[model samples]
Target chain A: MRGNRIRGHGLAGYIVLSVFAVPTLFPIYVMLNMAGKDLFQYTLRPLLPTFPYHFENYLYAWQFLARSFFNNLVIIGVSTTIVLLLASMTAYALARHSFPGKRFVFYAILCVLAIPATVIMVPQFMLVVQLGVVNTLFAVMLPYAAHQSLVIIVLYTSFSQLNESMFEAARIDGAGHLRIFTTIVIPLSKPILAAMAIFEVWWLWNDYAWPSLVLSSARLRTVALQLVTFVDGMAIPQPGQEMAANVIAALPIVLLFLFSMKTFISGITSGAVKL
Target chain B: MMDKPQVLAGHRSARRMRDVRIYLLMLPSLVLISLFFYYPAVSGFIYSFTRVTTRGAVWAGLANYQRLLADTRLIASFGNLAQIVVFNVIVVATMPLMAAVLMFRMRNPRAQYAFRLMYVFPMVVPMVVMIIIWRWIYSLDGGLNILLSLVGLESITRAWLGDRQLVLYAIMFVNFPWMGGLNFLIYLSGLQSISEELFDAAIVDGVGPVSRFFLIELPLIRDQIRLLVLLTVIFWLQRFELPLILTDGGPGWASMVPGLRMYHSISRDFNIGYGSAIGTVLFILVFGMTMLQMRLGRRRAAADNR
Candidate 1:
């Protein structure tokens, strides 16, 4: 009787979940299907493909959107690394040690997190232009690093929850602060760090506003910025090519999410629930 | 005795040295934050008061504020944003909550995993790509219309995003899938933390699912709901990419949101002062809403704990 009840619940859950899943997957499926078709066929028949699947759209997107995509990758890679390192070091100090003005500094960081990035975006642009890093990749990295400090604080809170006796044991064995951080703290904080890394990666990868502001050089555009240009630059109204570009743009992140879904979900949940 | 006092003094100095070491470790982040964050934040506020230009900013005092008030387009943008906020808060708050409840009742782990993954897939897709995908789906001969026609609801097959009347709601539909992951995750966690014994207790008391949810689960996860509502408001008020990509704030600015309007005012028109003013207004609105949310959240948390 219990087994039957459980099976019934599972069947019901599957049905309900599928209903929700359609909207999620349908758009991407349409994009893929449309991208594989020729433009003439797309507009003329609109419903059916008149030709075989062409891999040419991906190649075209690569050539056209290559610079921006590379730019986004560079921004994501560098900024995520910088944030992870800086945030980890800072979080370690805040979590494990007592220092003057620590409480004030922590609260100040929280306040900064509350201030929406949109509010500072215009002024930040002005500052970037004045500094003459406008239209440069560095322009993208600087603000991203700044805006991402909150993640550091979040990770720090998680790190603080670790048992103190472990640290004390390492200290008693004469391991120094840097050694403890490198050999002990980092390895144990893997789950949270991985979570922060994935979150930051997704954020920087898809970020549009700052990149749009700073990267005026066509060669320095990110994927998101490139997508905007792709749509705007289309002269013959090719939905297939546009969809192809989106697929190319979306593939890496989609793959990353699939591989790391459990880690990502758990990390986000743990961080959020604590708050 | 002199030696003993000297040893004690040395011990104090060593503790001070450790404190300095901690501060030194923290220094890099502090410097980065000060240079990049605090400096820009202060300058952002300062810039709001001045007329910034290629020649540099001059003290404009209340001129920018007055301009913001008088600009019909700016006012219209705020009005549009208010409506978007209402729609967004309702959809984001309600839909995911329902989906989450359905998710919690499921017994099979595999089915639950699949559902959770599907819900979160949209979040993984970049915002711009998602917008493009939605645009294609909402096209005149796009999948949505085709699906509608097949279901014998051909009258509902109007240009989904292109029609001025239906555009905003269409935008909301796109937002729905994007928000599901976060809300579902929050609700799932809240549900997991609720003891099964409580549900059993309620069932024994002859309470139905609806009443049990209201009298038990709803009151328990009040904090999550509050947090989600606050986050929904902030995100909606600052909404940009969807409007920017899908409508370009068009069909005659029918979907012109404040963030996009602020972008257009400056980027399209080079109206720096006007854009800054608009941004300041949005900042104030978000700040006010967030403050209200925090207060309510605290009150509810306090009451629940009691």
Candidate 2:
């Protein structure tokens, strides 16, 4: 009877796990199938991948949305670069030094992490309008970077894990704080930095609301916003090619996820750092 | 005495220089974050009390807050949002924990690795695409209803997004396969970090797998559970993306939440002050929830230590 129960439990485990697997895998198949077919084939063979593949769907999808992909790339690049440079600087200072107001700055940033973007967005939007950066990429990237003090805090924990003696020895050798930060701190934290880089890049690529609020011009929309605009009928008459735009919008993130899977997972698991 | 005083003075100056440089290094981030994050966050509180116009913000006192309290649409949206939060918290909190356990239980290393690969692949798909694909799935003549007709279950099939009664629940349960994505991975990491010796000791004491998990694993992984719960509440507090993408907060506000309402209010009516007022109230609620959980966790830790 004990042996029989053991066998039953083993079988139950597999069944339960397979059930979880279906939702994730099924959508992927559906998305690929949806992207592969035209409207007629989509109607008839919605679940099946039938060819001559309708590659022209991409052309239709891109007819009005191509500019958005470029704009998204620019925003992602600018935001990620600014976030990395500034976050590393703030993190380095917080990790290695003692100064007046250091505790205050750190605690303020901790509070900032909990402040939802939806809440402060109204005033943030006003500030952008006041700065005369409304309808500008700088508006999007500035908030994107400033709001990344959470990333700084995350990076701070990693920076704290660096070897103390190396930094002090460099300091003893008359190396300035800038040199020690650049030479010792940056090199030692490459793995975490790389992981944060991948995450911020992927994140900025998908950031929709901030851009939607800040960038009003049709010409300045990101790929994610473009898909929304297209589907909602504000952009253009893109006939029956949403799956194509959806596929394109999802592709870069998917490719990046596959490439940097290890670092991405590590970054999050690291975020589970004890308190 | 003179030599010692000179040496100490020199050391103090060097220390001061390092401190100043540290401040300088942090300068750019401080300035940018102040202008962008802190200034606006503080401004949100101020703006909530004003009526913003092309003529700049004019003081409106408690007018915006008074309007917020009486707004029927906002109240109904909160009622709807409360249901989403409870349902989301229950599903996202428990489902992923169970999956993490199942993954943790596997004996075959290769199988464990393969299952992880399968689960992790979906994290890459942009949130926008996921919502869009789900929209198509829920379409009137889309994959779901079509498949239902083929199987002779057409009566249950209906337009998922359009019908007011079904729209909210439809949006909630639409994530097929219902995998809790990153939360699942986080729990797995939490489980993996638990010492193997604790489980071995339990086995030696004749504990069953289920008993071992409950008695040992669950208590050990409380940190992960707390983390996920906190994150879920914070994210859902300002929940807009789902309603925005799936239904546009539509069919007469069945699926509308406060954030989307705020977005619409500011967009359509240009009621910036009222919108800021709504945002301020939400920040207080979410902030309080997070702080409470954090305090509870700390107390538990203290108790454990004692």
Clashing pairs in 1: A68-A221
Expressed as tens digits, the lDDT of each residue in A1-275 for candidate 1 is: 11112113345556766776777677767777778777777866555555788789778877877777677778888888888888888888888876669898787766766577776677777778878898889998987776656777777878899898888777767666799899888999998899888877776777787788777877888888888888787787777778888998888878877788788776656544322
Q: Residue by residue across A90-171, what tens digits does model 2's lDDT show?
A: 8988987767898998987777755666678889989989899999888887888776776788889889888888876786
Provide the lDDT at B243 for model 1.
84
TM-score of chain A of each: 0.89, 0.88
lDDT tens per residue, model 2, B95-118: 888888887777666877788888
User: Candidate 1 — which residues are off by over 4 angstroms?
Assistant: A1-17, A44-51, A269-275, B1-14, B148-162, B175-179, B293-306
**Count of backbone clashes, every candidate in sequence:** 1, 1
Error of 2 at B158 (Å): 2.0
DockQ of candidate 1 is: 0.46
lDDT of each: 0.75, 0.79
- Measured against the true two-chain complex, the DockQ scores of the candidates, in the order shown, are 0.46, 0.47
